[model samples]
Target: MARNPARRAALVDAAIEVLAHEGARGLTFRAVDAQAAVPAGTASNYFADRDDLLNQAGRHIHVRLAPEESALAELMDAPRSRELVYRLMRDLVARMLGDRAGYLALLELRLEATRRPALRAALTRTLRENLKRNVDFHREAGLPDDGDTVLRLYFSITGLLVEYLTAPGVLDEHELDDLVGILVDSALGIGPHHR
Candidate 1:
């Protein structure tokens, strides 16, 4: 409930770090304050409750991890194809892997949501908004925009990302590409074989 933007942002970022390293059970206002190297009660000052901090962490994580504008513009400028989809997936996976702790915290948030109706509803809304944004981006990039296709692609990529992030050797790039290529080809009906 504090109005200090810089301090609030730092607390939220620290919440992400605490969530990432400590999981939901370990996430606390005190932990966040400690992570941010601020005085005790700093997070409590800014957040209404644990749920508020968790929600803010989710938003911060998404912002921090979202694709760069330049990369997206490059994709938008390129020809849309299974190859492009594959590349996009690869980049997504790479980013997830690069921020393993953050993604893990997100996964924890998801699990925690399942046990709390309010959190579940909030997470669902946030996820749906993100999905809509992805679909819109796909449309703008001249990629597949069909709802079913986009939905399936979204889940598939998320699952694959989870697997890759949790267990590194589960699939090599060649294998991941092959899987993504199949999904992309199936979704958009693009690629050499589809042609």
Candidate 2:
């Protein structure tokens, strides 16, 4: 495989885009090269095979969607309240919205994992680690909710994202903030009487 970091990164990114648009079956070295606007066989030089490319693309999407340090710092500095939880969830939605293709690529990876054992294992590990990190961050921040609450929030947000991305009209865009607020409140047990 080639050792050009810049070119390799570019190819991985392009592979993400291709995966998002074309699904796992459509992902190919030639397609990746075309997506990257690089010469044919460029992706092959960097990736050992289709599985390697898919795995790399899965990792790259997470990196692309990760929260910014500044944002994390800001969240940590804020008071740990229900309101803060709402803001955090809102920020997550915004980040995913901003990188629609990255989130879409991740969804594709999840689908592809069902057929590929190696990918299934890799994705399962990565996703479990990510969930643990979020739970840890919530606890460390002294957030109002427990780790289970965080898990619930994660599932709820993922469902919202899937619906929002895959079936746009199914979810009213104007009600997104309201929907997120409801999810947070539900996860935190903030009912009408509590609020």
Candidate 3:
């Protein structure tokens, strides 16, 4: 991982760092090159433009996301699916904020990708697939066939995540957890009278 593949990986990895630290306007050849410690022309060689780089970042983020999603899915086998989801949510929040630059860049890319048809299509596919995976995670653990319930769960969480990213200062971690708990509880129909 120290040559072409390595350099490619480095620049790709640096994308979030560059975007987050530099904001949406900071995505450029020089920024990625500097962040990746590569020659200016090299990044351009791999990624011809900002859209190309952001597209790569989207793919990279998707790949990295699989493990965490799978881990959450696997933990469902432990007989504590709901608890696992809660923990996963908490961990996700921590991880998202752990590297403000990376997470912020993700948000920015997601926003801009919405304006690019190709990127938007890629995003739609990625989101749909991931949402299916998550819903399956629940189904595998005995969640009932609740029709649109899974879709609601996914988009609901997505909403929460977007709000958190856009207004990180608005809700502290505990508040976020509380908000998610409310949403999850409502989705699962958990109530004081029940549990």
Clashes of each: 0, 0, 0
| lDDT per residue (tens digit) for residues 1-195 in model 2 | 799999999999999999989988899999999999999989999999999999999988999999999997887677889988888999999999999989999999999999999999999999999999999988978898754899889999999999999998987655998899988888998885665
TM-score for each predicted model, relative to the true structure:
0.86, 0.96, 0.80
Predicted candidate 1 versus true structure: per-residue lDDT over 126-157, tens digit per residue: 88899999888777677655657677788888
Number of the top lDDT candidate: 2
Ranking by TM-score: 2, 1, 3
What is the C-alpha local distance difference test score of candidate 3? Answer: 0.70
In the range 73-136, model 3's lDDT, one tens digit per residue, is 5655555455555655566666666655666777777777767888787777877787788677
- Candidate 2 lands at a TM-score of 0.96
Ranking, lDDT, top scorer first: 2, 1, 3
Better of 2 and 3 by TM-score: 2
Worst lDDT 10-window in candidate 1: 186-195
Better of 1 and 2 by lDDT: 2
